[model samples]
Target: MEHPLGVQPQMGLFEGGADVAAAMRTRGLGALACLPDEALLNIMHELAPADLARLACSSRALWAFANHDELWKGFCLDQLEGRWDFQGCWQDTYLLGKQAKGFQPGSRKMRRAAGLQSDLLYTPWLCATCAIDPSWLEVENVDRRSGLSVAEFREQYEIPNKPVILTDVVTKWPAMKKWSRPYLKKAFKGGMTPACLPNCVVRRFDKTFCETAPQLAKDYTVPEVFSDDLFKLLCEARPDWRWLIAGPYKSGSGWHKDPNSTSAWNGVVSGRKKWILYPPHITPPGVRPSCDGADVASPVSIMEWFMSFYEHKASTRCESVGYTPAECILKEGEIMFVPRNWWHIVLNLDECVAVTQNFVSEVTLPHVLSHLRSRSPALVSGCAKEARSGLYDRFVKALKEHRPELLERVAAEEAAKKKRAQEQHKLAGLFKGPEDACPGVNLANGSSAANGSSANGASKPEASGSAAAAQNGTSAGGGFSFGFKL
Candidate 1:
């Protein structure tokens, strides 16, 4: 259909050059003017920063399109490489980074749109406000266990590689009562260091937030089930482990595994969080993680993943089969155990505050060791500088000196595994039976000895092909078969 504003839907808005753009301007964007911000942003996405900035100068509509933070953010990143020195939105980063060295930013004023709902601007708000259908919560399931002893946990879920929500684990944490957003905002009075800012370094933002205010660290303690963190052997030199995560609705992590092949526990302080977890073997729908675990190719936004793939996953996911993922709402004061390297994504259903820690455990030590040794140092993370440089060797050395029992147990386990393998090799082709059957064995002609058969006497003819198989109990190819007539 022709656009009411006379735009040919087939033609791009700016395809024919400045004259064409001027004509479109005089003619107005027509249907393009009426397009949803997202679709219009898609058109604007094709433009270069200079062209986009020029377009912003042309008119209010184009200015709105051109000034989007996302557009500038993409430009900010594509324009530079390595650690970002600037902090703020991509537009601010671009302006900040583009300034001459030692540039001192001045007091700047931000232009306020009078309730303009640009898809470039307001769609994120819409995604945040979109009501989560109740049925969305009921599609999949994971077991919920509480009051499990360490042995019970290891024997049942940890060893079996399953995800579970532990209800009573974090119930007594002081953070559960004290760590509201308002309290946190007050507790977090100081500004974050340059390294803690988003797009900076490898540490979690939550840890950075807590590091800025050391008092916040006292609000929670490690649960008994996870108190066996092997990283503690490295003490102050261990990699950053715990974090204080807080976010508004519709904000949370994308698909990822925890760092350094460590299992994790996320204990919610307040509000609701929806968790969707798949085992180590199953990658969540629409996620493509590189094999070495460095880069992820998937929708960076939680809303994008939900809007694009969640329903399809829910509909096709089967609880009794491979596609089903463990799904749950982790409410206030609850702790969730995410096994090592299991793929998971967490979405906040409300304003939320939580603490999460990734730690190496006895169950995951070997896996972490293999990951540390096999991956390049650049890809390895979640540790101090000295540990990061030679994590596998350092960890093994620490294990031998301080935690020799762990190594001894693992060595014994390895020896047992090798013994099982040897036993399997010895019995490769044998099965239980009362006696052996021999083919082409005859007591009168010593056919049994000639055919390497030890069995009751039997006579065999020189039948060939199918005839041999039928009369002499021989293979169709004329090879002797083992048989015995009891």
Candidate 2:
């Protein structure tokens, strides 16, 4: 006898599984059931998630095959619509989705320390750029008298990187007034001590600490702490804002550029914050001055130096070591926009309560997309493997067509800077001495020479003496003087 698909039949009744095969054949599923598991899986792979899901419901074997994680992973990649990677799509569906439970925030320390060697399973969060876009933030100068509406705000300051202070947005929320230092202390009890503060262990203010701390994570569960009406208003008004609350330390945030793909708005509800911004091309002045000697003499590189200083024992004392940051006291009902890729560090002035969001709007999309195209070609090109395929070819094409000059200029400047640094190091080795040993100090002092005055300009000689004493804790020579302001 012949099988339904016209192949010769096997001799035994149970060869094709009598009961199972007969039932499957009657239901027009004989071919699928008789096929090897691998062959069946290959056929199913061509189906979409929805179609595959429906097929899985047909039988227990089909269910098992469709439920295989490899299939799900492939399904996710296909569903990503070419905009995100498989891992990103999985994260969006399984981690960030509203239905997902016990979602954990990522740790910066684990990320930096592990680098690229970390297992993807252990570190599943998407990169900051993937998580949010800065261009969607809409800012409007809310008239203190006339009420601010969401539409008006979106229309005015929809550009990337410009954050506006919304005067009345959260004024009615009780948490706006209730969340404070005392409240945090009460909420966490003894756990609110300096030892438990965010980035307190490293003595740096890092968001990762807050995300990972057991106590803070538990405290974050306080349901309905924020008013439903307010939450709803924000959700309706700015559907794109990803609310973030950071707290309870004076640790300085790391200096980093906001991913150009996203814009952020931060509001400090209970305390003050100091923001230090450095232009994209320039390192923070303090960092620039200390780079070479600090990089050469210490095992820790210059990058690590700044990281360590900011991460150092969180004390108010070191606050005076550098330029005072621009101060802003964000109280209840105030908002501040942080534009894209602006390098900034934030100091939590008190037990701070704040909310922040990254957004994308129509006006900023062009700029944001352009930035993403330029900065993260690999991300757009899929991953390492696919990047070498058609993705890389597309990237090269785009570079040649749209940005050849810009790319060339960037390469040239990098080469020029490298050459200058090499020359400086050679010169330093030849003239190694106290005054000339560090060109940075000499340059700083020389600029201060014209003033011939103290930092406060109260008294030139006394100020000079104080500075000299502070430098090496000695005024050994009567002629010794320090000219620069602290």
Q: In lDDT terms, which candidate is top?
A: 1
Candidate 1 local lDDT, residue 474: 21
Q: lDDT score, residue 64, model 1?
A: 48
Error of 1 at 309 (Å): 1.4
lDDT of 2 by residue, 56-160 (tens): 667543544554445655543344322321232333342232333554434111111111111111111222112211221122232232254545444433321
Model 2, residue 5: displacement in angstroms? 87
In the range 380-440, model 1's lDDT, one tens digit per residue, is 8875544575877778889999999887777676677667657764453243233334433
Span of ten consecutive residues with least summed lDDT in model 1: 477-486
TM-score of 2: 0.32
335 Cα displacement, candidate 2 (Å) = 1.9
Stretches off by above 4 angstroms in model 1 are 1-55, 59-65, 71-129, 192-204, 314-322, 384-389, 422-486
| Clashes by residue pair, model 1 | 37-119, 239-383, 438-482, 438-483, 439-482, 439-483
In lDDT terms, how accurate is model 1?
A: 0.63
